[model samples]
Target: MSQQQDLNLFVDNSIIPQKVYRDEPLFGVITHTQGTSPSWLINLLIENALYGTCVINHEKNQHRQLRSNVVVISFLNDFDFYEKDLKRNGIEVNDNQQFHFIDLFTDLFQKINTPESIVKIFDQLSKTIQNIPNKKTILIEGIEFLLSSTGITSIQLLNQINKLNKIADALFIITGADKELIDIQHANPSLPEFKTLDFIIRLLHRSNIVLGLRPLETGRAKDITGTLTISKGTIPFDSLVVSEKEYLFFVSRETTKLFFR
Candidate 1:
């Protein structure tokens, strides 16, 4: 398929209003993996945001005029991990002013000795964002991991996200939505898994776009990585047009490949 066709099949943002803040375009990536993993889709979005363009097969495929600086708040991986991945993909995001990576995976818990420290994180993030003088997009990964590790309730974490959104221009989040996480049978609110499921469901209701990634029902294959379902969130704008579709995707050594159904 042509690159344009592929872009549309994935998500043609031209059809999206791309509003931020109150009408901010919230995109959710429902990853089955319990913890951090190398997600090709997340990296792709980061690259596009940083460069204001999309490069596919060593060529430019699309151009976005309004490029937003990226702030990565990762509970999944550290800076070195993402830096290495981007380097392997021929993009050097590290040290670039447009890209800022915050490693919540390392040393975050060690520093959270007091209950007050939990709230301090939001303050820290707000200050970090205030320093950046550009349209900002926050990429949050491993929120489930954070909820499981920290003492914050699902509502509190969701509120924190909204608090950050009040200052951020856009938001992109990655959370787990596996059966174990979302199951409500004999649900216990005290359990971290339950809180995580609650947080994700609430976010889904507010998201503008949702991407569900899971293993194939037919099982794994050498060429196929997994299945990706792209659809609008439960509360998309009335005037918006969403292309709900599913496709097979592969994560190769050099780049990602998407196959339309």
Candidate 2:
């Protein structure tokens, strides 16, 4: 398929925010998270906010040393990945602080698709997100969960994105993509989704600081869990490192190393 076709697909999916957030009926805090990268996104955001750096191995650093307003919003399944580091790094959040997650089908059906529950759910979730302090940076993460052919995660994700975008200057870290995206032909399909050049491009267009992970033949690629795709820009489970500047164009493998800095 042509790049325009690919871009069209992405724009079709993501267009709601680009327009809705621009004006009209605004809802609560909105953010996206993938089955992958919850750990890295949370840690990177916290580390950057606190130490102005990235933490490759937490055990090597002084736990008590971090001091910053860091909030990690994660889904139920992936919460454990960052739980230990969060406590060690002095960031704490109650269950209420985390955004409630659902898939796109449910979001459309129960929330948007249906007339009754959608607004109610949005109101409740929005209130929950709104209560969080605006000045503090929040790491929003949630699982899109596996959906059947009939199921959808888009509505729920859009809700989260809508909610979060309301807060000015909030460093929103969003992850996740349509599982079927890989079936599409991306220019550089060799790279992982999270690390793909297009993924970085789309991410940097939306976010201020983007760090995507791509696996290498060696190094930390072995244990890291996730699939990376350039065309789709979503991963099954893998690691990647992406930066804001590199997102707009072809990024060399060596350039990804800069994220460690």
Candidate 3:
């Protein structure tokens, strides 16, 4: 692809109104993809959708607005979610801020906390954005826990999200997904969803969205396009390129754009 075409492919295209998710069932459709899990993509879609309001408030500057609400919830121990990286880097969150990274999900959404307790947190958040009328946007990080560790079924997660959906106009859950694990159904008996992308496609069938970067290994990006690169030092594009030992993407939506090293 020409540089311009590549750039266009990467840029945020005009939202296809028919394509953008408008209701709960569509959100469901957006969750499941063939040979993959829909949870991670669900979060990505939520972030972008919630971001629209932030963009409107920020005078059409999505990046600046997103940066403001970009809470980097990390599953990595050293990262410890928020204290170590996002806050340390000087990202700030206030009532007027468009985006704020929520690094520590355990701290935010522990099931132990009563619904009332959770409601308090949401209630407090609502008071600040008085003009918005309702708190419709919340981007959640750390979905791998819900999938693998939360000790909850995929249906349960969807139900919980359904409740949250009623409270907020839009919600996104961010989690790490390793497709390789899902691709090998016979080899591993642990994950039932691993057998095919049916799980993912089914999940997304309820939601509307676009896929982001493809998983790959570090240094592979350099090999693919020596001239196209990120300024940051090279690392495995593990999500984009599948290694001999990893799983590759089986489904790619033609309407969605992809960006990777």
Candidate 4:
């Protein structure tokens, strides 16, 4: 399929309102468990970059973008991994001037415990934003990993996000947690170290848009099922209520559709 067609299939356009990006910074949370796959979210991020939306990728380079406008920052992985993945994803990486990869792991990891180092990283991020053109969307992946690895608190991350929102027109974040563990914690209500759940809840409280993806409960092999919960946002279709509402969705490689059922 063409790239445009692939982009359309990656997301359900009916669930997103027109010009929603204009009103507020778009924040998205995508959750999945250990066994489930989050490739759909990765595809969505790539689509955004391919569509000429500036992307600041931080997902550790599981995928690649062909567009020169996409900039990737590799934290946990090496630059070669990103180059290989980009090629695997059909994105050419032949000394492309537009496509850039910044290796942050070496410098940041050496001084991860120092407050000065953290501040330096944040300063670098700010500088990068300043250079980007105005009114562009920034996609951030692996937020959870960043926090856990760097020992950054939720408040600190939120503050960084707020800063990014001030500079960028829109922002989308992708984070994942184990669904089964969350369920076990929910049922027990006494499990310790619900850190993932706590982080997810805190982020959700601050997010304008939220999406959850998991495998089908019925064990169906054809499609994945999840819930798309919207709160304090507008959607394109009138069928979606403006207020907080949860809609069940089926996602396959071919398409993504939302419904009440």
Candidate 5:
């Protein structure tokens, strides 16, 4: 928005509310349209949690007084890709001791084919963070990918997520809200698309905050890429304070810029 607003940027990153997440656990959900990418936003969050500050995020001047250990379970991108992006934002994912990336994208073959397989995955994922001594912030990208790939049901997946959620100081789930995924015209509970839509809806209901992204409603503009909307969730914590806000953002090869919408 403005230089003055940058002084108070996201609660200290004011769009992100770093203060509210300092002590208690935080659960956030982000949904993106098909053409809009949430990767840059996710990278910014990782930077905020790991470094406790923002360098080239939406606003470079924002600050995080509390740093957290970050664990990311990504189903859409590989380590190499994320590593490259984060490096631009000052995170050395490979060398950092507190940053962990679980590459479910490249290693999706570890699918849950049976009930025992599901347990193995649940235990493995949990143990990964249980060993970490610091306060943990876990981010899951494309968790819905698990639905189509594994035999695990939506209820079962949500249960595992809830248990994992309890382990972290902050948890963020990123999913696609593209209409194709959520369309219910010929709803089939058996399909993973419908299953994923249901899963995302439940998450939205429980999440304290939701950061949503979508393509420009009007025709494309050279300077703007998409819009980011932050809204309080259905069951947000009474203590969690956030106002519904929107921003026009542009992500370029080297940096991201934001403008009041």
Candidate 6:
């Protein structure tokens, strides 16, 4: 990809539509390949935090926005490990209040063994958000992880999200889906065996906005030239609009530019 192509990927006027940042509740599902990391999701979260928005993340150990108001609830690793990881990723952690790491591999297993314990966990999450005075944007990295860990039904997870949405006064709730499973189902329509893929479909149906990320067509080793597709939702620009349609986007480390494919 040339520099012009990279520049063209960014939305015109160097501004995303106001509707993209509106106060109304927005639920988005981002689908990405399994082996490939979803780096754009982190970029989006950091951008939101740069604008002074409070981002509450429930995800694995990854680079976090180095802002005091950005809260991360890490389940994959310990606090020290996350801090080291962030530093390695070129992100500086100036604020001590930025992370709240919960080692699920150790602590969660000890406490949350039964279904009742799972309910308490959800209750605790709800209460934590309730105590925070302002509106929050919750970004849950692995919906599949939650399902596999707790053995909770898809309907139950949806209910938990709904409950959190109500208590947190959440402006947006963003979660991820597995694209590899989706691709498998798409390739072979005759053999539909993955229940996890079915749950992801349900999630996409439930979301107001759905964005998909895929590797570049060239099959490069690095995630240099990927595609972003808006499978649903309409975001209105100043004079132009993107609605009720599928739009293609070119994504890089620098920018995500959208255009009609």
Top lDDT prediction, candidate number:
5
**lDDT (tens digit, per residue) of candidate 6 on 48-105:** 4434221222222434333223334434445565555454434555554433333444
> lDDT values of the candidates?
0.69, 0.36, 0.34, 0.50, 0.77, 0.48
Report the C-alpha lDDT of model 5 over 86-134, residue by residue, as the tens digit.
Answer: 8888667787888888877765665645646766787889987898886
> All candidates: CA RMSD in angstroms?
3.4, 13.1, 11.5, 7.9, 2.9, 7.5
- Candidates, ranked, lDDT: 5, 1, 4, 6, 2, 3
| Model 5 misplaced stretches (Cα beyond 4 Å) | 1-22, 57-66, 110-116
Which pairs of residues collide in candidate 4?
17-236, 33-179
Looking at model 4, how many pairs of residues clash?
2
TM-score, one value per model:
0.85, 0.44, 0.45, 0.60, 0.88, 0.63
Ranking by TM-score: 5, 1, 6, 4, 3, 2
Candidate 3 CA-lDDT value: 0.34
Q: Compared to the true structure, candidate 4 yields what TM-score?
A: 0.60
Which of the two candidates, 2 or 4, achieves a greater lDDT against the reference?
4
162: Cα error in model 2, Å: 1.9
Report RMSD for candidate 2: 13.1
- Residue 258, candidate 2: Cα error in Å is 8.3
Candidate 5 TM-score, C-alpha based: 0.88
Clashing pairs in 1: 20-24
Instruction: List candidate 2 stretches off by more than 4 Å.
Output: 1-38, 50-71, 76-81, 88-119, 146-156, 177-181, 185-205, 217-261
lDDT of 3 at 142: 41
Global CA lDDT computed for model 2:
0.36
The TM-score leader among the candidates is 5
Residue 42 of model 5, lDDT score: 90
lDDT (C-alpha) at residue 39 in model 6:
46
Residue 228 displacement (Å), model 2: 11
